[model samples]
Each structure stands twice: as C-alpha cells, then as structure tokens.
Target: MNIDFTLEKYKTLCETISNSSYTTFTFEQYFNQENPPKNCILLRHDVDRNISNAHKMAMIEQRLNLVSTYYCRTTERVFKPEYFQEIAAMGHEIGYHYETLDKAKGDVEEAIKIFGQELNAFREFINIKTVCMHGNPFSPWLNSNIWNKYDFRDFGIIGEPYLSLDYKDVIYLTDTGRTWADKNIRVKDVIKDKDHQKNNLLIGNISTTDDIINLIKEEQYPRICLLAHPDRWHGHLIDWTGELILQNLKNIGKAGIIWYRKNKN
Candidate 1:
C-alpha cells in the first residue's frame, strides 16, 4: 500500500470527480464561461516521442469516464501522421505542443517564422485550435518562446491557456520535469500570480499529489487546469514513477551546476 501511493494518487484524483457517487462532477463544458462547475480537469499531454505517452494517459482518463486534450509537437522527432488519426478517433482534443523559441534559439524573428511553419504542419493532420508551450526550461523565454515571436490569435487559435490564464485566480498544476511544483527552473505554463495579485492572470500551484487530492476533497476553486506531459504519465506505475523521479533528479542537478557557476564568478 505504501509503495502503491504514487500510482494510486493520480488514479484516485481521477476517480473522485468521475465517481459522482462519492463526489459530484464540476467542470464547465466550454472555455471562459462564467459560473464554471468548480474544478475542470484539462488533462493536457505534451508529446515528443514517436509513440505517444499521451495516448496512454488518454486511455486511463477514458477508464475514469473522462476526456482530455493532447498537444503534439510537429517536430521531426515527435511527428507521426497515422497516430494523429488514431488519437482523434479516441475522441480527445488534439492541439499543438510548440517550442518555437527553442527551435529558433535566441532569434525571436526566426522563432516566429518557425512557429507559423509548425502551425501549418499540425493542421495537415488534425483540426488544432488550442496550444500549450513545451516548457523548454533551458530557454530564457517562457510562453514568449513562441508567442512573443508572433500573435497566435491571428493564426486562428482560440486560446493558449498557458498565456491566457491569470494564475492568481485559477490554480495551475503541471508535470514539468516530472515533479508537481518545482521552484528551480522556469515553468512555461504559469498563469498564476503567487504574490496574491488580484485581477492579474492568476494560477495557484499544487506542490504535491496530495494537494491535488485535497483540493478535490475541499472543493477549493471554480476552475482548474492540469498540464501533464504524456511522457510523464505513461499509466504503468514503474514507468510513471521512474520518469518522475529521474527527471526531477536531472533538474536538481542542473540547478546545482548553474548555482555553482554563478557563484564561482
């Protein structure tokens, strides 16, 4: 039971809202609607693998009687046309997972050009509307990695949640570097104002898996969107927990190196 907690935690969170008998459902069916049900689980998947971990997460959500949105990168390493049709077949919303700034690597102008090109490529297979940043931690820019280079709304995009949400009001949760709320690196999907700035783009951070469960228990907010990487949640306990632990370790080590170099100078 102790060993099973990590795997059980995410599953339990899914089951609680889906259960209905134990807890009632509270999610608005549309975006930006006032009087939202309470907690809307926007299960997001960022794909970079040839085979999608997002697909597996979608399957788990299906078991819980839920659906989610998946954002796949159009880069050579992550591109797969056949899988697009299959994922769309599963009834999940398909989106573009973009890392244009990283693609440009400090050239904001080139990043914009590449973003438009990538956007064009993604539309070839699926009807994509929403987008989420790939969270390229090493990049100096966050959402601006792509958006700062260009206006996504001009491309017919409805909303890019990472940029659109004010984190102060909506609680922001992500599986970046495979941990819950990490303090060291730059997180791309930060819509929250942690300083308690009201009227700004607000998003709260959930530091632990237990925090997520407790929120469901307490019925904290009216709207919440969880950003998860398909690469993080592969469904199997060994793989999921292993990835989370290993990735966070890598991030910690990277932070140590940066700190050492900064102080050495």
Candidate 2:
C-alpha cells in the first residue's frame, strides 16, 4: 500500500466530507454561530512556511464549496499579504498564526504588544476574528501561554483552538510531524487530555489521510477538528519526497527532545 500527501489525496478527503453528514465550518463561523449542526468538521490550515502551498489548499477547498479558516504567520517566508487577500477573497476566513511569545523571548508584555500590532496588520488583509498559536517546537516559550496573562477577547478575537475548544467534546487531529497519531513528536499542537484519548477507541486508529476519510465514511466521530499544515502537502513528486525526508529528520530530533524532557524530570 502506497500513501502520499498529494493534492489528489486532499481532494479525496474533501469529497469524503462532502459525502458525509458532517457540516464543514471555519473557526470564526463555528464560534460565532449560536447553534451549529451537531455533526460538523472544523477544517483549519496553519501556514507555517510555504505561502503558495497554503493558496493551493485554499483553492482546493473553495472548489469543493468548503469554507475553512487559514492562519498565516508573519514570518518573512510565510507572510504574503496578496496571498492572504486571495484566499480570503475565496470566502475563507483569514487569521493570524501568532508566535509573539517566542518572538518576544518569553516577555509577556512585549508579546502582547507585538500581538496587537500583528493582529492589526493582518486585519488590513481580512477581518480576523480568530487567532491560533504557531508552535515553535524548538523554542522554550509556548505561544499559547501569552493568554494566561492576557485575554484574546480584549483584542476582539473570538477563539483560539488550544484555549476555546474542549477536547472532551471535539476530537482533535493535527498533521504535525507529517503524520497523524504521532503525538510523541508533537510539541504544543496536541490536545491536553491523554487519558481521555487513550480511552477513546477511535483516537489512535486513524493515522493517514485515507484513515480520516474512512472515519468520515463510517461516521466515527460527530465533531472533529482537523488541523492541516499546507506546507506538508505538495503536488510535485520532488517536493513531496523532500518534505518526507526533512520531516523524518525533524521527527528524530523531536523524539530525542521528548526523551530528554521525560528523563530530566
């Protein structure tokens, strides 16, 4: 069996969503609505590095008549205002993938100030109602921790998945470390409840895109939050192979880090 992260596979995933009873929603739409459908899939894209890949994914979703939320990082490589505008013009929600805590070197005040500035800058492209933390895996500071000292609601942000979404109610799945069910390599892009996940039989069963499509076909979970990094999904064979090699190297490094953290404690 061969499984590759290509545009075709992504389209298959979207088709599965279309065929199922699950209603697709952007993060803003999911939070703002008073009473959304019980069975819904919250599709989110975190544009960590590649801007073009993000646009491709957004176009794919738009072609399926699906509106998903895209979080853009304000990095030199990923921050493209025109791309953000293009994606937002397709009726997708645009948001900030913030890394202010890491950028500010754990300074809460500085992080908050930077956050405000970046949020305002992003609003110039689209009305951003939600923000998500960009997990700087190698950094000592967690971006989500900034909320402990300050509130996002004060900034007119409606929701942050790590803070607002309850894992008990919604099953969270992220394509971190280039694969699903590889939580050991994930730094901060994971649900907090490990015990609950272990108890849930369907939690670790899905590993690939096909696994997720099958789950959707089976109607396994009523509510699912699918988090995808567009940089990992590529159309070209060379690019796909390169990403796989790079992610494998990163996975080994992350595994070592996890081991060190456990033994040190």
Candidate 3:
C-alpha cells in the first residue's frame, strides 16, 4: 500500500475536494454566510509545527483554487510572519491557534494577557478575524476557558471554530493521532456542542482520506469541518518517518491518558 500522510496523498485529497460538488469555505466565510450553500466543506489547518510543510500544502490548495483557514501557534518554531504572510497572500485566512491557558498554567488573567500580546503581534503582520484554541490533551486546563472571563470579539475577532461553530449542523473531522477517525486517543478535539455539552454529534464511520473522498462523492454529508494539522502531512521521508514514529508514541500516551481519565471518573 502507498504511504499516507505524505504531501502526495494530501494533493490527492485536495483534488478530490476540488472535483466534488462541495463548495469550500474558510471559517470566516462560513461565519459571514446567513444561509450556506447546499454542500459546504470548511477547510481548516492547525499549524502546530513544521510550518514549512504548511506552505507546501497551502500552495497545493492555491493551485486547486481552494481557500482554507490556517490556525497558527505563536511558539518560537511555528511563528514566522514572512512564511505565514506568503500563505495569507494566497488569499488563505490566517487564524491564531491559542493555548494561553496551558501556557499560563490556568491563570485566566495571565492567559488573557498573553493572548492579547500574541494577537497583536499577529495583527502587525496580517489581519486576524478568527481564533482557534490549541487543545493540548495532556494539559488539565482547557484553552477555551479564557473566553468565559472575556470576549474574543473584543480583539476584533469574528468566530472560533470550536466555540462558535454548531457541530450539530457541521460534522467535524480531524487528523489527530495520525488517524482520521479515533476519538479514543483524542482528548479535547471531540465533537461537542458549542455549550461544551456532551458529544451529541457523531462523525459517522469515516476514517481515511479515501473514506472522506467517498463520502463527498456520495453526498452523504451536507456540511463538514475538516481540521487537519499541517505538521502531520509531510513531503520528505526523514521528516515523514520521524513524525510517524513520534506520533505513534504520542498516540500511545494519549490513549493512556484517555484510559486514566475514564477509569478515574
């Protein structure tokens, strides 16, 4: 079988999305729409690390005339304004992937302060209208909790996919744990309602890229929000294999974390 998670596979996925009748929209575009089209796919990318790979993926989408939203972390390794600017210049949306709660170790005030500093830094280079929380499975603090104390819109933001999107209307799919369909290893990326309610929405049986392609072809879902991490998809063998091995270990840790939380409850 061919290797998955490579840029080649990602190109195939982009091609599939482009060939389908589904109209692609960024999160900002979706928020502005009062009545979205019959079939819509909100393409989102979490640029946790390996931002260079994100540029490559962004170019693929550009060539395919596909616009996507890239949520970036402000960590030293990930936050390069010029590289990200190139992406935004392609007409793609750049959003903040914030984890201030985890960074501030659960201090709401400190988290919001950090959030403001980083957001301003982003705005200096490009306009940011949307933000997504970086859900660290191992961290006990939920990043979105900062919003309870303050409003993200005050920062001139429009919406957040996790907090603002209604999962009941849009099915969420993420490439966490190096797999498209595994809630056992995913901690905070679960499909929950905007109220932080229980997981009321089901992601169906889709797992692999082929599964997503087939689903789009069949028109099974009217709306979808695909959350893919750029670091998870690579073009080089060394980087690809290294990420695979590391992610396998991380998945084991995540599964263990899930088990501990379940048993402790």
Cα lDDT tens digits, model 3, 86-175, are: 999998999999999999999999999999999999999988999999999889999999999899989889899888887766767789
Question: Ten consecutive residues with minimal summed lDDT in candidate 1?
Answer: 20-29
Give the candidate number with the greatest TM-score. Answer: 2
For all predicted structures, in order, the TM-scores are 0.77, 0.95, 0.94
Q: Higher TM-score: candidate 1 or 2?
A: 2
Clashing pairs in 3: none
Candidate 2 local Cα displacement, residue 192, angstroms = 0.8
Reference-based lDDT, residue 129, model 3? 92
What RMSD does model 3 have? Answer: 2.2
TM value for model 1: 0.77
Residue 248's C-alpha lDDT in candidate 3? 91
Can you write out model 2's per-residue Cα lDDT over 1-265, one digit (the tens) per residue?
3555887788889888887888899899989888655799999999989989989988988888888998999988988899989998998998899999999999999999999999998887678899999987788889999999899999999999888876676877778998876558987776767644753455556678888888779886778888889988998889999999999999898888888888996
| lDDT against the true structure, each candidate | 0.62, 0.86, 0.86
Model 2: CA > 4 A from native:
194-201
For residues 1-265, write the lDDT of model 1, one tens digit per residue. Answer: 4332243555776776586333222121235455434455556666866346655556566677776777777777667877777767776777787787777776778877888888888788787777777766455655454565477889887667667554555555666666666455433444445542342223256566666667666655555566666565554677867776877776886677557656897
